[model samples]
Target: MSEHDFHVHGPHDHELEHAAQHEPKGFAGQLAVITAILATVGAFFSYMGGATQANAALLKNEAAIRKTEASNQWNYYQSKGNKQNMAELAAELVSSEEQRTKYRDKVARYDKEKADIKLKAEALEAASAQADEESAHQMHLHHRWAQATTALQVAIALAAIALLTRRRWMEWGTLAMGGVGVVLGGMAWLQL
Candidate 1:
């Protein structure tokens, strides 16, 4: 061909050119862009959901460990009580005054140790409760993120249907669903 008549078209160029001329200008492009944006947001929400779930599990594990430690401390406190009881009995049964005084001293020491053990056990129990509460909160956030992801997925599906059916109302529905997804994601971020 002469340079004046020379032309080049890629495989889809003719089809795209014809479509651009026949279809409503920018409608397909707008839908494609919006769908892409929604997909990206959905991916982020999905990731947040997974992260929150993992955090909840970890917090729950921490709570369990703390609870176990508290149990152990309480057991130790009970052992000290038993020792104090044995010393009190020994003091009562002793014949010598000097031996009785020694048993009393032992009993007093065991009482003090039991008090310290009791305080530690209580503290650990409080910590375990706090961690358990935090874990529950994380699970709540995870649920929010999961809901947001589901809404975005629904929006993406609606976009696909709108494209296939060429329905304007479907496009509006897609936008509404996407907006709901964004709101849920925001709520998740705010821990509400």
Candidate 2:
């Protein structure tokens, strides 16, 4: 048979399909339903964690870019200041009034340019700071999502264990963990 004509299953796939078809009753059925729900919740949490992590990374990159821009503006401001100082010194040394006035005009122009550059640099710095704050918040949310996902995974594992061991305590443990996972997920959603 051609490769396209064949089908393959992972180690647990056959058993999973069988379980789906059989649909266990009573306690096992309840455990199965809870496990399915937990799995779904875990998937959502995992997705949110990844999305938040990506947002954090993107915001951090934006912050870095803004910081670089601010640094460049500061450098420009410094250069303008240096030019103004040179013009001031030239104005003092020039004997002719016309030459002195020209140098003074240059000094004034440089001063104005420096002021504009400083303002731009300060604004960029503020923008960078804001981006950094946003990135940190996203990272915090990502961590919360990760925690929720972990708890749900643990709950799913407990459900499997309870199903195999037929232990009442394990079932309770699974429910407790599931509740914790859901609560964490809610907290993450609320950004608390």
**Residue-wise lDDT of candidate 1 within 103-181, one digit each (tens)?**
9999999999998999999999999999999999999999999999999999999999988787888889999999999
In angstroms, give how far residue 192 of model 2 lies from its true place: 0.6
Model 2 misplaced stretches (Cα beyond 4 Å): 1-25
What TM-score, over all chains together, does every model reach?
A: 0.90, 0.87
Worst lDDT 10-window in candidate 2: 18-27
Clashing residue pairs in candidate 1 (N, C-alpha, C atoms within 3 angstroms): none
Candidate 2 local accuracy as lDDT?
0.94
Compute the lDDT of residue 16 as modeled in candidate 2: 78
Q: Following a full C-alpha superposition, what root-mean-square deviation does model 1 have from the true structure? A: 2.9
Per-residue accuracy of model 2 over 1-192 as CA lDDT, tens digit each = 687797789879999777667644467888989999999989999999999999999999999999999999999998888989999999999999999999999999998998899999999999999999999999999999999999999999999999887787899999999999999999999999
Our tally of clashes for model 2 stands at: 0
TM-score (C-alpha, index-matched) for candidate 1 = 0.90
- In candidate 2, the residue pairs with backbone N, CA or C atoms under 3 Å apart (3 or more residues apart, or in different chains) clash, namely none
Cα-lDDT of candidate 1: 0.95
